[model samples]
Target: MTILTIPITFDKSHLITIGEKLYSESIELIRELVNNAYDADATSVRVTIAEDEIIVQDNGSGMDEQGLRQYFNIGSTEKRQHNRSPKFNRIRIGEFGIGKFATLAACGRFEVTSRKDNFAATVTFDKEEWEQSNNHWHLPMRLEAPEILKTNGTTVKLNKLYKKFKLDDVERRILEGVPIKAEHFEVYLNNKKISARFLAGQRIPVFEGSEYGIISGELILVSNTNFIVGGPGIEIKVKGVTIKRDLFGMEINFPQLNLLTGEIHADFLPITSDRTGFIKDSPGYHEFNKVMRGVLQRVLHDIKYWQKQKEKKKNRRIVNATVDKVLNALKKNPELASLIGLPVSPEEEKQKTEGEILPKKPRVKRTPAQKRMVSKILGPSAVVARLKIGKKGISCQLDHFGQDSPESYTESNIIYINLDHPLYVREAKNRERLIVNVARLLTQELTLLKNPKNARQAFDTQSKLLKDTLIDTTP
Candidate 1:
């Protein structure tokens, strides 16, 4: 009798069959490049896109030969000379050490070129080799010292495009992922500046205040007011590689709200590839959170305060509608006047004195605008003004008797707006611009309402905003 036996040995980690990693992870790739740009000290960045090509160029300080080799490594083992962190002070915006490889997901080929002190070099990443090889994480191309290069910045060219690309969409994604300023480090998508910050749909002016935050003890801070309002993205600090992003979702949903919905500029908030996903517990997250702790609460308080004002306005509208309905019904049914304590008979009313016998229709109540003014001036620090009803609308008065303001606002700023509307006009000193803008918008809406042929009324509560009065802001 003859017997045969076979022996087998395999490593558990390498058993999986799919050795090739798909390049569908586009957003992270773009993010890596953007973060690297920040590390290069770039104030002006450009992201250019075509059907088959994606280019990211930044004007940050370029790299030297030794710097290039160290940057190519996956980890910053060489950068550990200064132990706390390898990135620049927070003012510069990078902290993590791994965003560089993100770009590998976008193309079959990628190239990087940088120059420092009159010397330049180029490096290529071959994706085919990465996918075909057993270990898919390392760069396939060798770093060759170039004979000549004039410019002193880094450029990454991603070829054999992995996914369909669109310029508008990609630009938007960059805006959300890397909140850079147009003036400080102007960012352009196909040479056009992005505008997605203000309700006006244009760039907001830079608030003249500069501040910094210490995330991982790197210089990370959001400076200026205008850029955040324009279309600012994010900055990462990794030792090697560049990443790309999806370019659409990140810009619109970066902070879980509209671009104009909240304040911007916090460094330590590391990000993942899509650009919308932020790392909440990064090395310096807690320190960064310390600065933002009260800020978010104040923002929430402002929103709630606005909401309460809206509720009051809604109630006012109902009361006004009820008053009008009662008046109309009263004219048609004169018989019920006596039940409401009005004159019973026409002859009896004629015999009575001119003004003494008949009671005036119960005076409708009103609220004074002064009360609302005080609330706005004091904001969450104080309570809102009290209100009284009038025959047609409501009058609001400052609720606190001890409060007084010698300072006065311009007539243009003294606008009485009902809370039901969502028109957030930018900061302005002239009311004409705001009023005219509102008028044009409302007129357009009215035109639509007049021609609403079949469905529910266009002028219904859900579709329109009503503002019937204006009070002066001057003392």
Candidate 2:
């Protein structure tokens, strides 16, 4: 078999602007180098921003003569062919071969020192010279005695800084960009270790069944919708590295703002040459959107359910306040308190239970105002009330009312307003109506306790009179 070698030709000047064309943001340049370190299987990578230059150093298998040649190849796929790191078997992140050259986007010149086995070499790239060298493509290089470190590794120095940036801002960008999740891989910026932000939320699954693969991630519910734009969103991750910060470029009918913030780890997702985002039209990306759409729907459902729970809690709190006031009023009024004793005889218990001796008809009809008060406390349906507050100000599940009736008359001193009533839902919303209704119930109970003979009759009379007179006033 014969192997034929053909030279691939392109404008060498393209190298000068290749980085700029690929990366619009300056922070992307830093990500390119860190990805290279990850591709090298470096356990630890340290990036330093000095007075005049930025240095990125890693401890991993470095390059020899052949390796360096492959590294400089304009669009080499050496990392892709290898597929994984030699030591850790980590998925390589720099397959497009533009990462190293991307440094030119941030600096005018840069130097790389690498060592492997007993061989070590240093190479310097001058962007100005590359652009002016009459199309010459070679960078200055030298073979050297290994002094970089005892172990195999690579160090890249970007000098003649193109732009100045805050160290803190740079660190934050790196934190969001790099794949710091791989095992045995750690990154340090200015000697301080960069830790992945703690994302706390519910986990959602992506691409459950597809030709590509499935990835799992979590959705953190954020309150501030604006933060979702500035902070990271459903990050699109490939090879454990976040390719897209969020669903910024993609077309998504997001259910709500600040509703879905999270990271997805889909290694099969295709990315652009700059590695800043994913290929939007690719089948893999489309599938990701499909899976995430389902996730967001479920997230929206959860949001609705949570809101309902909160509203219930708020209504329960209002019922609790009304109950507390009634109890306090009963405690202060001695006459009402004296009427609160339990029946000692079986006959009295029967009379209270059956209401046989009481009036057969309702002495007073519900006025519209009183009716509205009941609706306010009970809510629209007034079918179920799950929350109860007692005299102790303690919350418990007590069955004070057995039926869906307007009110439950019990000998116990505790007042359990039926929040499920229509009137409580409507009129009890007003403070004056709530107080009047509470007083009406209290007077009814006191009359029942005062005279078992007329207890039922007096209770009915007082309830009707209170409704007609007290609720007649304007809300």
Candidate 3:
């Protein structure tokens, strides 16, 4: 057997490819750089965008010579090993050190200047020059006196930019991608500090613990008229930095979910190499997903409940208006009122107008048993409308009385419309159809009150009443 050594070498183009794939957009490069500062225990990071260059300055624990070497090294494990910042003990945000290479996609050349302890140095990496040097991997470095930097920090300057950076876009990306909410940490774009985006809506808080770690955040059900900054979706963050905005396969499931916007943090979830998504196959990711699913289920339930309440309120308004129209029609046509045993003669009308007081009938109150029976027949969320025609009062209630129950029935002066009736449930999907169904039910019940033994007469009377109430009153 012959033993031979095999060497694995990487081409300069590979760096460009990786950077383009990882960053994708020029704005993403800024996010990676800002996060690097955060991992270095930076309390303040200032990003400046100019016509020809972009600069990122941080007041973090800057790197020494060896630290600079580690910074340039691809896929360095130093941050993963430490896992926390030396001064602040903040959970490190940078896991794959290749984040630095993201600059290659946005600029032709970039320079890093750092000051730490007694050392101060600047390293410049010119993309064109580096690619031309076949096997040479070292970058140009200049030693500067410690006085060059007034404080221990790092400044990265990207020159000969491949793309222009917009101030607004940079500020937004940093606000979403960096851990600005961390204690003592602040990010600025062109001297203006970046703060978390505010959403005005109902906030649903979430906190869950799994074997991996704890997931915590608030989900917002944005107001219908309010414009969401980034549209609908919950931002998923790991280690306080947002990875992506996701709805977790719920965008199409519920129409009300289009108004959802918020963020969730799960520091223990394993992320993909680009840091744009989680590793779905990992145990940590599964646990995080489980927790998020439960949270979203609750959100769905709340949204449905709110929608049902709103619909009920709207329907009640419609029902009241319909009832008023029915009463007005009955008053205009004494013949129809007489069919329901509420005759309003001309003499009685004159007496009423002359202020002749009529004896008031005592109102009847329901006993507990009767109230329970009403609840059972008309559901708890039933909408009730009451009106007086001539000397008689009538009560109309809309509720679910089961599909097997009559479309409508009268109990004393009360008329109940069965929402669960097959015809009613079908017509309820349309506003106009629902109004017609309710008017038809009310006409049937009122006409049948007097002509209980005559089905043909009741049907004719109901048809006339329905036409008068719906056609004459519907505007």
Give one digit per residue, the lDDT tens place, for model 3 in 1-475: 9999999978877876787667667678888899899888889999999899889999899999998998889889998999989999999988887998888888899999999979999999888898899888889889999878888899999998878877777877887888878899999888988898677888899889889888999888887725677545888889887888888787787767778888898998888767788889998888777778788888998887776676678669878888877776676667656544444877665454432122222445755434543667555567888756445567888776667777787666678877778998788788888888888888787776654457787787778788788878546
For 1-475, candidate 1 gives per-residue lDDT tens digits of: 8898888854322211111232234655665687567656676667787788888887677777777777765446532343332233324333434456666656677788777666677777665664467644555334445434445678777888777766656665565555444234567778897654433322222121223343221111232425343243322322222122112233353342132322334333455533344455665544544544334344334445654575445434443443333333333334432222233356744443233222333332333444444345533222222111111111221112222321111111122233223231231123444443333333233223234444455444213322221122225
Better of 1 and 2 by lDDT: 2
Give the TM-score of each candidate.
0.48, 0.73, 0.78
| Candidate 1 wrongly placed segments (more than 4 Å) | 1-24, 77-90, 129-150, 199-305, 321-475
Give the per-residue lDDT digits (tens) of candidate 2, residues 189-289: 99999987765544444435556787677667765555564354676677766676564433255445355677777888888888777788999888877
Top TM-score model: 3
Model 2 regions lying over 4 Å from their true place: 1-9, 200-207, 223-232, 247-257, 334-475
- Scored against the true structure, residue 407 in model 1 reaches a CA lDDT of 17
Error (Å) of candidate 3 at residue 345 is 12
Better of 1 and 3 by TM-score: 3
Stronger candidate by lDDT (1 vs 3): 3
Query: Highest lDDT among the candidates is held by which one?
Result: 3
Ranking by lDDT: 3, 2, 1
Q: Considering only N, C-alpha and C atoms within 3 Å, which residue pairs clash in candidate 3?
A: none
